[model samples]
Target: MPEFIPLISRQTIQNRVREIGKQISRDYQGKDLILTGILKGAFMFMADLTRQIDMDHDIDFIGASSYEGTHSTGQIVFTKQPDLEYRNRDILLVEDIVDTGNTLTKIMEFIQLLNPNSVAVCTLIDKHERRKKAIPVKYACFSLEKGFIVGYGLDYDEKYRNKPEIYDLKL
Candidate 1:
């Protein structure tokens, strides 16, 4: 097994998720909130976050893939999208991590084409230094250092996602 070093504890993640949810509820009070979760990564975070959000919000999933064994292929091939029409709706895109910003930019651009009232981004982890585009992260739980992270919905080779806490995959 590859060595794993503890990063964020499970308790810490739960606390942060609740905080982000509260903030979102406050900011989007009385609005039609639609959360678009980027799939295969943000599924866990999306579930926890949406539960904490004390509003009647709709949830949807958008599947976009760009990783090939820990390296982004620099191309986002969208495989799935939401069925609901996003016109004039407050759309929040939830992501597991924001790294190169390429995938998120492409996803946001695609959503923008739907004529949504507004679009915002919320990420569980922000790899700020790796960003290549000026994508705004309206809400972020943690800012990760330069390293390969796994667990707590993040994975390496599709493993470690079941772990309840975040860890650094020590190579």
Candidate 2:
């Protein structure tokens, strides 16, 4: 088995998720909200987040990919998108991690076409050193300079996603 170095603990992640959820619930208290998750990676984060929200909101999923194995291909490919009407709904785009920001730009562009009332982003992890696009992340759990993390719904070549805590995949 490949060695894994600990990064964010499971307890830390849970605390952050609950904090962010409460903030979102307060922000969108009187609006029709839709939490649209960017799939595969964001599944675990979204599930935990929504439960702590403490408000009525809808959920949906959109799948986007740019990774081929453990590396990013620098190309955005979306495999799924939400079917609900976005014209007048408040959209919270949830993502697992933001590295180059390329995939996020594409997702924002696609969602904008539906003319949602407003759209904001919430991400579990942010890699500041790898960002190539200026995408504003409204809510985030953790930020890192550089590292390959796999766990808590994040995977390395479709493995290690089931781990409860975040870890740096030692290569």
Candidate 3:
């Protein structure tokens, strides 16, 4: 097992989520917006953010996978597809973190084909340093160095999902 190093504390994450919610609310004011959360990893963040939004919005979930063990498979697998018709609707794709951009890139392509009025990306953690493609992340809580992070919806080998604080896997 890899040793874990403490990263973002639970309180800090909560504060950041509040700020992100404020930003989203301001940006999408008076607009009919739909939030589509990337499942498994993004569920926690999506739930907290949606509650804090204070605006009229709908929520849905989609499941996508990339990481296997400690590395990304470089391929995305969609387990559950979004159920709503996205035509002319403003869509926000929420993720737990943006790393490598492979998963998000593929997901964005899929979303675009649905013919939404507009689509944007929002992530709780932005691993910008690790991005290979120029995937635009509209709303991000924090930018972290390339590392294995867990908690706040991120996971480690399917463990640590319930941890409130984020941690890094010591290699």
Candidate 4:
């Protein structure tokens, strides 16, 4: 087990998510929007963000795997392929966190083949220092410079994801 330190509270996360949702609502108003969440981690965030957004939009999930334990293997494998027709639709990839960004980059490469009208990213936690690729993260709720995080749908070996608040996980 990892040592857990309280980081972002549940209330704080909700408030920020609400703010992002409002901005997204304004930005994509009168446009075809699809909220495609990167699964497992982003599931909780996607559900909460969906309620916060005051607009009609579609919800979907995509899965890509890169991490084995705490470290990323640098190779992305799609666990779940995108099922929606993205052609001419604005697709927003929602995430729980962005680390090296290799996963999103690979996912984007695949989605581009679908010929979506526009594509963007939204994340609950943004780790800019670890970014290895240029990701279009349009809406980010929180930014963390370092540390492995857990809770609020983030996990370590698939544990601690049920916690409502975010925590710094020290191995």
Q: Residue by residue across 77-167, what tens digits does model 4's lDDT show?
A: 8889787889999999999999999998998899889899999999999997788998888989998899899999999989999999999
In the predicted model 2, the residue pairs found to clash are: none
Whole-model lDDT values for every prediction: 0.92, 0.93, 0.89, 0.92
In model 3, how large is the Cα lDDT of residue 153?
Answer: 77
Model 3 earns a TM-score of 0.96
TM-scores of all candidate predictions against the true structure: 0.97, 0.97, 0.96, 0.97
- Per model, how many backbone clashes are there? 0, 0, 0, 0
For residues 75-108, write the lDDT of model 3, one tens digit per residue. 8899999998888899999999998999999999
Q: Which of the predicted structures, 3 or 4, would earn the higher TM-score when compared with the native? A: 4
Candidate 2: Cα lDDT at 87: 92
**By summed lDDT, which 10 consecutive residues of candidate 1 come out lowest?**
126-135
Model 1, 11-106: lDDT tens digits are: 999999999999999999999999999988899999999999999989999999899878889989998988888998999999999999999999
lDDT of 2: 0.93
Runs with alpha carbons beyond 4 Å of true place in candidate 2: none
Cα displacement (angstroms), candidate 4, residue 164, comes to 0.6
Best by lDDT: 2
